[model samples]
Target chain A: MSRKYQAQIYVTLRPSVLDPAGVAVASGLKQLGYESVEGVRIGKYIELSLSAESEADAKTQLDRMCDQLLANPVIENYRFEIAELAASV
Target chain B: MSRKYQAQIYVTLRPSVLDPAGVAVASGLKQLGYESVEGVRIGKYIELSLSAESEADAKTQLDRMCDQLLANPVIENYRFEIAELAASV
Candidate 1:
């Protein structure tokens, strides 16, 4: 039997890493007359649907997925939330 | 006087938009031996810091920011949460 799960992953550049997109956005805001825009950081939000046998199994698999390709460990950090997919009658 | 506020903005593609990056990620997960990946959607997570007079002001400003530049209104929809920045001390 297979159980469904949903995962939301957030991948963000490490604080030490320079984020050009963030810089660009900040400047864009400034240009748009948002003088109070103090800072901005851009990150990736990924929503994934998976079928697994158990919550632990789903988490383990998702973690491996994040490490292998979904996120670049060297330059970014990733965090995720997993929830059982509600059964659709 | 200015009060600091933090806003977390989530920008997601509309249902009708074709997400090439999402397709690529789903396929990549499949190739990585996770065949249970039913679907994937990619979006943007942005963290913003601003100084405003009140929460209402913060929400208004943030809404305008999203409308004007943070997100592409044509293809993407954005939602945000704003909280007053606690005084450091």
Candidate 2:
């Protein structure tokens, strides 16, 4: 049977980029009675499951995907994790 | 004793808003050998702990915060959850 892999990617704007969403969420928290909330930044989490021959191959594919499509090198950055799944008992 | 509240806010770009970060992450996953992965979008999760008199008040404050800071009304949207904590067990 082919091995299954799971990848979780987190993408966020570089610190220099302006994030209006982060600002708004922080303001909303304060209004919701969370006065102590501060310095909120927004990012994305993506989870994917795939079939691969090995962990090394999976990592290579994920890296290429990030470079070609998942992240914009001009303004954003991304990180991903790939894990192999064991067959169900 | 004052009530403690936990709020988690998720922020995302509106459907119409262009997300370069989302695109990058999707591509990254594919490179990592996840050929089946599709339609990846990115967002933010914010966790906050606050003291409030009541759930209603916490909700009100959180709403205001979202409106004022946590989210950018023009390009992004946000949603949050608030739960009260019980005394230490």
Candidate 3:
């Protein structure tokens, strides 16, 4: 039997990379009177739902998904959390 | 003394809203041979650093930031986690 899993993945730029979009958002917040926002960095958050035979299998597939399509490993780092949703009938 | 806080914010499309970007990504994944990807939803992940008098103050500021600039309340939902970094000297 296969289990349903939900994966929440976060892909962030490496600290060494410049994030112009984040800088723009920070400035926008400041202009809108959010003076306390000192800095901001923006990234991608993705949710994926899938079915796998086991937790390890789900994780392996998720890892490959991130590496192959979800993230650009050169300048971005990706991490994910997988939660079991249900046992598929 | 004021404290430094780091905020991680996730902003996702409301369930009722159609996510064309997610649909595109799902098809892209399929083309890349990730046939197991049943569904995909894309969102925004933001990291913020700021100084606040207390945790409560930080939370309040973060909420306002999200409402005012970080997220569109009509079509998106946002949530955030805050971690205390250090006390200002």
Candidate 4:
């Protein structure tokens, strides 16, 4: 039987990279009324689905993609999660 | 009075941009046993804390940052939200 999969990847810049957006948002939050916020960092989330014969194969392919295309090793870092979809139950 | 704020920015490549990372994650999920998964797209999330005197000013500055530095207008898009922290509650 064919199998389906889902993956969520989160990407972010290294702390050293300047995050003007993060700073602006933090400032905006202060205007809105959140007084306890300390600092903020921004990142990315990517979700997708695909087919694979086995979990091990899927992980291997995914890791390659992350290293080759998904993330820029020079500045950005990424993490991902994989899960199976329930079969109509 | 001093105020604290938080901002969360979500960034993603335009649909036209190729997302190899997204594809790999989808494939990985399929291998893990998810047979019903469909397509996936990946993006970014950023959270930050800062100080602001008022909401309007904060929004203005945040928008400027998004347009100027946070997001790459050529390929990526970004959105943000700001909220205040309750005092001693």
Top lDDT hit: 3
Best by TM-score: 3
Which candidate's DockQ is highest? 1
Give one digit per residue, the lDDT tens place, for model 4 in B24-81: 7667656765554577787877776656667676676677666765678899877788
Model 3 Cα lDDT, one tens digit per residue, B1-89 = 78999999999999899999999999998898777788899999999999899999999999998888899999999999999998885
Q: Candidate 2 chain B: minimum summed lDDT over ten consecutive residues — where?
A: B32-41
lDDT of 4 by residue, A1-89 (tens): 54566777777888788877767756765566555447767676777665666677667666766676567778888878888665322
The DockQ values of the predictions, listed in order, are 0.88, 0.26, 0.85, 0.33
Query: Sort by lDDT, best first: what order?
Result: 3, 1, 2, 4
Which should have the higher DockQ, number 3 or number 4? 3
Q: Candidate 1: lDDT of A65?
A: 94
Q: How do the predictions measure up, each by TM-score? A: 0.95, 0.55, 0.97, 0.54
Say which docking band candidate 2 falls in. acceptable
Please, what are the lDDT tens digits per residue for candidate 3 over residues A11-83?
A: 9999999999999999998898877778999999999998888999999988998898889999999999999
State each model's C-alpha RMSD to the native: 1.8, 7.1, 1.0, 7.6
